[model samples]
Target: MPDNARRPGTDSTDRVDRTDRAALRADCASCFGLCCVALTLTRSADFAINKEAGKPCRNLQEDFRCGIHTDLRTQGFPGCTVYDCFGAGQKVSRETFDGQDWRQAPQTAQQMFQVFPVMRQLHELLWYLTEALSLDAAHPLHGEIRRGLDETDRLTRLPADAFTDLDVAAHRDDVAGLLLRTSELVRATVPRRKKRDHRGADLIGARLKGADLRGADLRGAYLIAADLTGADLRLADLIGADFRDAQLSGADLTGSLFLTQAQLNAARGDAATKLPSSLSRPTHWDR
Candidate 1:
């Protein structure tokens, strides 16, 4: 199964306009609660109970809103807070299905559930491609990034039936290649000596407090519960890095690459945690 959904970020150095990213952020108010029903919930720290795919959560109201929206963490459903469908939920609900919700048209439920995930992957790629195009450092590959963005956007608009046969993995690989180049170009601005490569490393619970990790390649690194207090991570490539329960207090991530709001939502941080202007501080951080 695919991982939960997410979104993108931008900053002052971004070349792309912020208004163009409206379709990349989740709009729950315009959705049909697809995430609540389409995703399987395991009985873990993230969820209060197990829920099978296509089955609505017990907390789902008739209006397609979570009943415990304000108290999700207190109700043991913190996982719901970090999930971002990258605006795929509404696209699937309104565009793909013509706004016909599962409750009204039970026959469409199965197909909608299957297509939702595929649409999400396409949308996630769009998020990354959009962010890549925004970075001034990636200007050398702007043409290629734009092409990838256009292609991914086209894929997202494909007919729902076309999704079943779509080779998303291949497309993702193609996009990943472009993003890798983007990461390299952006991180190169930092001094060669300061560039730390920890790609795919197992650093769970590692003590990295106040560490100088500027321009580090931390892709797919396992940083669960790691201490990153006051760490300097400017311009680091954090794509696919697991920051769950990790400490980000006072960490400087102003120019971090591929650092999404979902990642920040999963980790612990405080008011002093510096972030890119494009990303917002998680409300839970204050609590």
Candidate 2:
């Protein structure tokens, strides 16, 4: 069976434990063409062409798989390669819609497209909440993380219209505050060091190899194509950090705050890169 095939007793509203990583990871085999159709892209460095929302990409297959899945980067679809739906595509496809596909039931296509992005945001929060709950140093804030995780999960299970109408940004703000506290709590254990504030700094293509970035505030910083090889990123606040094409070989992110899979996938890494147990090494990383 596929990785995300429906397990017995698992339904749309079922609440799994926060530590269940399988539920939080993207299960492409279980997803319909949600990402290919629901998302809009503009022609830029990230995308080779432009596409409007609710329209299927030319490369999307009738079976709901990308035609250029193996060569997306080479085929000028690098953005697609870096995108992660955080398991929302599968949940919205299989559980929410009960395996009803947009192609078969075109009437529901509009609603499905609208709900996909909302559910994607909720699931992203679930990823962060789940990881927060796993931090031993953040035990005191486990209650907050659990509450956020429950609420986020509940949001994902809502009906399509309800999910679309949700004020996801407001919920994200609430969860962001909690995550900030969680970061502070975890980083407190690290020995006192100079606090580096690189929030929103543009370090694109800059050389940061082997730099000490411990306890740095890198929120929203653009590090695209930055050479971060062997950098010490322990206890750094990496919320919204752009790491696309950054080199992470031998870099240590053991306790980095708010690092997402999408960010990791966008960057280049190797087996020597150190990461928190909650996050997996990107498959593209060189072994």
Best by TM-score: 1
lDDT of 1 by residue, 73-158 (tens): 99999999988888889888877887899999999899999999999998888888888988999999999988888778767667
Provide the overall lDDT of each model, using Cα atoms, as 2-decimal numbers. 0.87, 0.85
Off by over 4 Å in 2: 1-14
Which sections of candidate 1 miss by over 4 Å? Answer: 1-19
How many clashing residue pairs appear in each of the predictions shown? 0, 0
TM-score result, candidate 2: 0.91
lDDT of 2 by residue, 1-287 (tens): 23443444577334746547677778888888799999998998878889999989999999999999988877888888789898889998987888899989999899899888888888888888888898899999988888888788777767676875689999999999999899888777778777677989999998999999998889899999999999999989898999988999999998888898889989999989999887888776853
Give the Å shift of residue 181 in candidate 2. 0.9
TM-score of every candidate relative to the true structure = 0.92, 0.91
Report the Cα lDDT for residue 51, model 2. Answer: 95
